[model samples]
Target chain A: MILEASDISFSYGSHQVLEDVNLQLKPGMTAIIGPNAAGKSTLLKCLSGMLRPKGKVRLEGITLTTLKQEQLTRQISFLPQEFNTTAVLTVYETVLLGRVHQLGWRVSDVDTRIVNQLMQEMKLTDIADRYLNELSGGQRQLVAIAQSLAREPSVLLLDEPTSNLDLRRQYEVCTLIRRLTDSRGISTALAVHDLNLASRYADWVYVIQNGKLRCGGEPQSVLTETLIAEVYGVEARVTIGQETRPVITVLGPVPVASSDFQSERDAGNDV
Target chain B: MQGTTANDLNQAYERLGRRRLAVVVTVVMLVLVSLFLDVITGPAALSLPEVLTALFQPGSVSEATQTIVCTFRLPTALMAVFVGASLGIAGAEMQTILNNPLASPYTLGVSAAASFGAALALVLGSGMLAWTTTVFVPVSAFVCAMFCSLSIFAIGRIRGASTETIIVGGVALHFIFSSGVAFLQYMASEDTLAAIVFWIFGTLQGANWQKLAIIAVVMAVTTGLLMSRVWQLTALRLGESHARSLGINTERLRLQTLILVSILTATAVCFTGAIGFIGLLAPHLARILVGEDQRYFIPLSALSGAFLVSVAALITKLLIPGTIFPIGIATAAIGAPCFAALALWKRRSYW
Candidate 1:
């Protein structure tokens, strides 16, 4: 199924967070790259039906607003940027809870099978009994992702999913999500801060700048030195190596910040 | 070597579920045992055989013994069970929605509102209603408790029903009602002051068949409603944002559960005159024994609460032999130290 958001605009009171943002997600890995508070998270929220934008979001040719919450949630799963819990819930139980809409007095066999299979596939079986609070940040992130997949959603959306991870864990998580997207034939979209990570893993890339879609295409075409310097307000060099993925090396922030760059910097600080 | 198989994983999870079930069953048995002890060990000092005969076969026992067992003690014993169960469920859901370990019916001013209502009745009698003092006190308390609860709900609704709004509103209401009670006490005559003090001390002495039935019916119906949303409640422990992303409609859930908890608490405390700490203590103990899977957590909370108050009732009878101690005072005197000890002893964090 294709997840489409068209001419979507959203604001927090009078301050607009997103304006005329249009995007589409097919069955592959799509990364939304932007600086802080650039409406990446807000747009993802709009597509997942967590927020009501002015324009319409449709999945498989049907409008999102027409569907009930339970049905909408069953098709699209969302993982927010910050989700940490100290409550004493175990890993297996947390994963099973991904099927919260379908859960009954007795857990069904199909739900059990899905959770068990996902745990094994994610290599989370060893720590299935460990409490969520006891796990490291990276492990918890992996468990959160596993829980999201347990919903069997056709579209999966994540916001800053690797914000707290180490370099190695970030690469591993991105790789796993990419593999799952291809294997399961589900459209996966991630809002990320790292340009190189998006270049390495994402099949399609969309750059959001100041609540609007700046540019989108294959990473090699969309991620350029001029584009990076313009959108991110930093001097950077982009090179396509033998691996065919663009690599970005940052120089520094723009020497003389423009008025627009300064305002975007201020908005980024609000987050 | 092969990694763990699906069969082994399933077995491990099922084993954990079984263990939690066992804990719940154990608490249920302890509650029943406490109920029996409460009935048998009152001031009348009947023998075990005599108490059993009076309870099951009243014809064989003497009329006085039967009256003592069935008429005088039975209602109070049963009241403790139902009231404790009601408070337990209320506290468990309150903690979940408020996202605070210390939250309870008392934290939301339900008990204090009830107290002020009782003080109004005891100090000034019923001015508007023609009912006797016997009916006036409880009715006034229930109305006042509901009033406090609804006002908090209204304030929360206006402010988007955030946790902070509800808690702040409840705290403000608590202080207002507490001062109202104090003012009433200051203006009362000696006899009325004594009556107010006695009611605040919270005795189960006023328990009757009608009050017991009302609490039982309300508790059963509310519990059934809560049980239907066990998955949603458990999802709440994951944090509000996550639950909302999963389409739980968290604001609506919080409001709906708050209403149910208010009704449960008002009914339970209005009859018993503000029984203390059972609502606050039971859910924490249940969380320690069983984690936040509401399937186990809710039932275990109710059972543990029923067990604690039932035991408190028994201690009230046995503490001074002939003199019945005020149940609220006994509950605090016993429960506080026990809860403290449990907190210190448990290596795992119960919160």
Candidate 2:
């Protein structure tokens, strides 16, 4: 396991957000899926060392709490959901900030090479000189991914990487993340809201509900109609695709009052 | 990959080289101009050649010109440069750490607290409490400034405070300190009252070699120390959580930076009274010139601040034929309008 959490629990004062969570992650793409307020992002924060957990996190035989921050950063790169840069930094300069973990004060020749290569690979070369605020949502997402990849960390933690992208851009970002993981053998853990996207891309899926892990396995095993209905409080149907992955479709909630519908129909007839 | 890497490397070098060249040229030109202009300012008219000869060879010029250049004008000019640089760098550090454009030493109530401490010392007389007041006026000022900053920081650390909350807290603290100084001024003796008032208005007239030496050594050492931590400061610009993920002890950095800024501000205030706006203006000027890279911003801000103060002093000296105005008045007169213009211009661009 590249990262492992043992009986991790956390709370904001008396309100518990995560309870007795145990997780072990290996070198692959693991999608964390859940309803809102399920502590998916919180777990990711703990794993990425952004927040301290109640229990221990161990990575490569060293306890995470004991390791220096910079050392951990060298191995793990985290992309938060939102960021604001007050400085009018260009795309290239912003991405180069990712390399700050490796290069301290001065930028070396190798650092420049890595940043440039990442920019080209991310298809941001044309707009590299443009300020960050000038970019579209999808373009900014791409630049953000490029920045996360700048340090060339062993693991990448992304919090809803595709949340802000449109349908087409969503696929493009997921594909890029998938390719980076597969080709470079980089470990990735993504918190995703879109179940279908998670099902299509995730090698492993962990379902979380009410701050506890509900299920953890392959996408086909973890993503089911019963689990979805129970966790999300919505009626949904799941169909297994030809590719052997599940697709979920939300149906309208079970009708509770026929009288209200009849009254609406009578009112329409009167009009 | 190798070819592309080489090309990128070359481009990075060229960009860095151009920026470095621009900064170097600007700094050198500004320093030369400031030095020449500063030497010729004073009531006793001495030509540039006479000032230079007096400076180089003390016996070459008359006693009056020599005393005027070396004792009065030179010390004031140097003090202006040192004090201005301290304010500029402190402002840059404050803004970066707070992650707010409006965060300056003054905005954070650092200068106000320093002024309050100075006022207290002057009104109560340094002899009242020998250890606390007399020997430690600067130390007391430093303590008060740090206290004010820490309070503002604590207010911001409260969950759900937008940047505006901290700014509001700073403004409130400013009013509190200003009122405190006013209270002190109310009860001061006639002799000490004039001195206190003049001090509050700020003047370089009391600038002497001993004081200038203290200001220079303190400002240079503090600025240099802070400059060495530019990488850490840059990481900090990403916010505390992000900085911690990058292996920085964010709280520790904050504490250290707060102390450094307070010390710098206290040192300047102890010597030059309460000179406003240098810290506010210099950092903005440096940011415009050097981009937001703190490594370049730190030193550039220092140099630009020195140039600004020196120039301001010179202009104030030459403004009237026979009368000398306080440096603080001239700086405020110039700084306020420039600040207004910049605000209007930056309104659309500031995010």
Candidate 3:
């Protein structure tokens, strides 16, 4: 296993976000899929060392919290769901910042070479000189990913990497992530909202609901209709496609209690 | 992949380099001009050549000229530079730490707290309240500033308040301190009341070697400490969780920076009284010139602040041919317009 979390628990004051969570990520893509309030992002934060847990998160047999910052940063690269650039930095300069842990103030030749190559790989060489604020959402996301990869970490943690992107950009970003995992054999854990995207790309899936792991297996076995309806409070149809991936479609509105129906109807009639 | 675009890239690089070089040159020129202007503006209006001669050959000058140029004017000018630089760096650090574009030292209530402490010292007197005013003015100011900042930090931490909340907190604290000082002024003797008012507006009339030495040492040490943490500060711009993931102790870093900024602001306020707006304006000027990298931002803010204050002091001295205005008045008069211009420029950029 490249990354492992054992009996992890976390809370924000009285609200428990994660409890007794155990996970193992091998050198492939693992998608943590769940509804908004599920402990998916929280668990990823603990594993990535962004948040501390009561138990242990070990990467390559070494405890994450005990490791030095430079060592941990070199080992794991985390791309947050939202970030703002204070300066109008060029793509190259922003990407170069990823090497700050390894290369202090002075940028080495190797650092520049890696940044240039990543920019090319992400198809960002064309806009490398453009300021971060000038780029479109898709272009900015690509630059952000390239920044994460510039560290060349063994483990990558991304939260909602495609949330703000359109459909084509979403597919493009996911494809890029898939290529990085397969070609470099880097272990990746992404908390994704689009279940179809997760089912299509993830080598393994962990279904979480209400701070507990509901199920874990290959996408085909784990994304069942009952699980979707139970967790999301929605009626959904789940079918295994010819490509061996699960296809989820929302069928209708969730059933509401009679009281809720009467109030909604009254409000609607008034409108 | 190869022809005009490659040429465009090369041209862009060249343009950026040239622009950066121009900014550097302009800053250097401004510093020199400010320094020179500071030397010439005093009771005895010496020519530029006479000013240079007096500076190089101090013993050759008459006792009155020597006292006017070296003892009185030079110390005041140096204090302006140091105060300006410290405030500028403090403002920049506050903005970066809070991740708020509008955050400044004043926005965190550091200046207000410092003014309150200074007012307490002036009204109560060091002789009567030795513990609170004499030995503890800066300390009390620092503690109050830190306390107020922590409150704002906590509020933001819970619901994750925006930059606007921090600014509002600062404004509220400003009013609170203003009322506290006003109450003290109302109860005090006429002489003591006048002194408190002067302190609030700020002045460099009492500049001395001891004050200059203290300011110099604090500015140097604080700037050095912040410079070393440039990388960590850069990581912090990514957000606290992101910073923690990179192995940085986010809480510890934030605490350390807050203490440093509080100390720097309090110390300056202790000597120069409550000089406002330099902390808010200087950092913006530095950012515009040096980009957002803390490595450049910290030093550039210091230099730019020093230059701005020095220029203000010079202008204040020159405005009244026979007398000098308080450096604080000049700073506000100059800083307010610059701030207005920055706001306008920002609005234009948005459009």
lDDT of each: 0.87, 0.78, 0.77
- Evaluated on the second chain alone, the candidates' TM-scores are 0.94, 0.89, 0.85
Order the numbered candidates by DockQ, best leading.
1, 2, 3
TM-score of each: 0.94, 0.90, 0.86
Model 3, span B88-120: residue lDDT tens? 898888877777667776656667766677667
What is candidate 2's CA lDDT for residue A84? Answer: 54
Off by over 4 Å in 3: A84-88, A224-243, A246-271, B1-18, B126-170, B348-351
For candidate 1, write residues B220-306 as lDDT tens digits.
888988899999999998888888887899888888988898899999988888777888888988988899999999999899889
- If the candidates were sorted by their lDDT against the true structure, best first, what order would they fall in? 1, 2, 3
Q: Which of the two, 1 or 3, has more DockQ?
A: 1
Stretches off by above 4 angstroms in model 2 are A251-271, B1-13, B126-143, B150-166
Docking tier of model 1: it is medium
10 residues in a row with least lDDT, candidate 3 chain A: A253-262
Number of the top TM-score candidate: 1
lDDT by residue (tens digit), candidate 2, B95-118: 777777777877777778877877
Clashing pairs in 2: A69-B247, A70-B247
Full ranking by TM-score? 1, 2, 3
In model 1, pairs of residues that clash are none
Report how far off residue B133 is in candidate 3 (Å). 12
